[model samples]
Target: MPLEFAPANADALPLHVIEQAGLDGWTESQPKSVVTWVRANNFTGSIGQVLLIPGADGAPVAALVGYGKPETRARKRFVLAAAAEKLPEGAWHVASGLPRDVAETEALGWLMTGYAFDRYKSQTPAKAGLVAPEGVDRTRVETLAAAEALIRDLVNTPAQDMGPDALQAAAEALAAEFGASCTAVVGDDLLTHNFPMIHAVGRAAVRAPRLIELRWGEAGPKLTLVGKGVCFDTGGLDIKPASGMLLMKKDMGGAANVLGLARMIMALGLRVQLRVLIPAVENAVAGNAFRPGDILTSRKGLTVEINNTDAEGRLVLADALALADEEAPDMVISMATLTGAARVAVGPDLAPFYTDDEGAAQALAEAAAGAADPVWRMPFHAPYEDLIEPGIADLDNAPGGGMAGSITAALFLRRFVAARYMHFDIFSWQQANAPGRSKGGFGQGPRALLAALPRILNL
Candidate 1:
């Protein structure tokens, strides 16, 4: 369901946020009866704690939400998300005095916490609504929240329903909604069209592999996005153990995030020639499955030795990246759930991005901070270029020793594109639930990218 934003209502319940230091003063300002009730209930201003003030009519008059001590930094953004989830059904608005940006962030968080994947199971929709916070772009916040919901929904879906063809359909639907042109090069045609690596990786699956492309915008700087869309990864000939394959359904998270970001760009009507390329495939095992040690020539004519079939995400992405590079767009962003090493380096909450563009990197870092989408910049580390170099082929899909798995994987993909690029290695699935973030497929850098684009492109 799309996020709901209600018109401002004077009768809406007031949501007052209180820090530990100001709790006493806040209680003192209320009626003596309310203050006695608050003290009786032991309503200390601890983060995520909620206390509802009662009216003489026995209905809720206002809500007191704890912002924790000023020193607690972890619960900064999305501070009111938990309250949004816990508050009684009604129209609400922040009544506390807060900086515009902080109010915007908290308002966005309230909308985000309402998201629940109810595709299969019926769910009671959230009845609570928020009046658009003053000084916040209500439409932009709703658009972003909707885009993120799309990402999470797509990622949380099981492989049976979210296969390669379904992914293509999702892209086509998004394109149609935005008046963008959408097309797909499917099946054995991938070979004829020169996406050999993509074809090889997906040949064994019942669903055909496809290159889904969508183009929008008539003018401005060209921005291209490429995502690895491995719908279900079985590790091909190098099959993963049961535990390893448990969450493989989330392999298409990169594609989901790309589409999410694409939706944001088009919805916001950004002045940029936008192109999205997703190499949709299912890396399954079968008699015809591509094996490790196989050498495949990419669309760019660079040969790759597949040291591990499990490294198939980068292979498909290489071809797509090469296609994105052919036009030499002003900037290219590639996102993929390509390596576990990245998760080890930064954990699931922080996406690790690689780029040589310092200015763009700084802009993304700043944007991430403001958007509550954390991204850590990892060096492209030119020295690791040799690690991806195999004696038999121009590049190795999987390097030996595994010291810098994520770095080497980025280096391998870097060869396919010549334009200024940023690659995000995202662990799309959240292992545990957090405020405003459910334990399912998540969009890592799309929000950060959206925030950074205007500044980076000078829009």
Candidate 2:
């Protein structure tokens, strides 16, 4: 469903957001009849609770949504999203009470709650159009929400419909929409182009592997993004258990997220010479599949011993990062659903990012707070560098011990790029539903990056 904004003249119902502490003062402002009705209905201000204020006509004239108290951290972010989900179908506008920033967040939340992955399903979600609150940029909110929806759609799709070829198609479509130039070096061309690691990991799949590149903007500080696009990870020879393979389709979530961020950058016309690289592939089982013991040469000329074939995301990303680093862009951001260790450490809600730059880390933290996108900084611990080294090769694809899996993976990819880089180990799938996010594919790191780009690129 499209993210809807109410017209100025539209008869939008008023949405009053009240904190539990202010409930008494709020009731004083309400009509006696309405206040009595609310009391009779046992309406105490609770987070995510909603009360419909009735007019003389016996229809809801306004909505009173509880934001809990000021100390309620969970409601502090996207409090009004619950109202969006429960509100009767029609246009609604926030009533005056909220802080400007809070209102803006509420507006974005409303749009986010409208997202539904109905590609194969026939049931359309109920419409709850919201008017852009005062001081909120409607265009920016819509662009972000749409980009997130794009990410969700791409990751939610099954492997049969979201293979390597399909991923390229999605990238090309996004490029076309933004008037950006896009190209793909597919099949054996990956080898000819010196993306041998990418080629080696993906050569066994029926759908050939490819590097999808997109370029946008004419003049500005160069910003490059690299995403691992393993469409379906059967784990190659080190195949995952049946349970482990269930969500394999989301292995390409990194690619989807980068595309989503690319869409936002181009759509918002950010002043940056943006370049996106996605090594789209499927790590499938075949006679020619890359083996755990195989040592493959990367685009950067580093040899990696495949300690585990399941660790294919970093292989593809390494080659792409190398290609990205040749230009020596001001900054390169690489994202991937790389390791289960990340999930174990930070859980599914928070994206764990690694970078050596202190200023960039601070900016990311601030941006994450501002955008309501959660990210935790994981160290690029110099001590853990030894863990990635195997005696036989320049690096081990999978480290010896199970410890610091995310950090070791980051260290492996760090070998390829010379530019200031940040690596995000993200769990793209949401295991449970939340206010604005559903229990499906979700975008991580992009929103935080988007918020930080202005300062990071000095744009």
Among residues 3 or more apart in sequence or in different chains, the pairs in candidate 1 whose N, CA or C atoms overlap within 3 Å are none
lDDT of 2 by residue, 1-459 (tens): 587578867899988887778788888977899899888877777778888988899899988887777778453557778767888888988895567866666777778888888889864554788889888888898899889999999999999999989999998899999899999999999888899988998999999999999999999999999998999999999999999999999999999999999999999999899999999999989999999889998888888999899999999999999999999899999999999999999998899999988889999999998788899999888898888889888999998768998988998888888899999999999887677887899999999999998888788
Clashes of each: 0, 0
Model 1 Cα RMSD, 1 decimal: 1.3
Local distance difference test values of all predictions, in order: 0.89, 0.89
User: For residue 280, what is the lDDT in candidate 2?
Assistant: 94
Q: Tens digit of lDDT per residue, candidate 1, span 1-459?
A: 358677765468888888878888887777889899888888888878888998989899888888787577464558777667778887887788445767777777888878888989977545567888778898899999989999998999999999999999999999999999999999999989999999999999999999999999999999999998999999998899999999999999999999999999999999999999999999999999998888999999999998999999999999999999999899999999999999889888899999998899999999999888999999888988888889899999998896899999999898988899999999988787676777789889999999999877778
Off by over 4 Å in 2: 75-77
Which whole-number lDDT from 0 to 100 does residue 63 have in model 2?
84
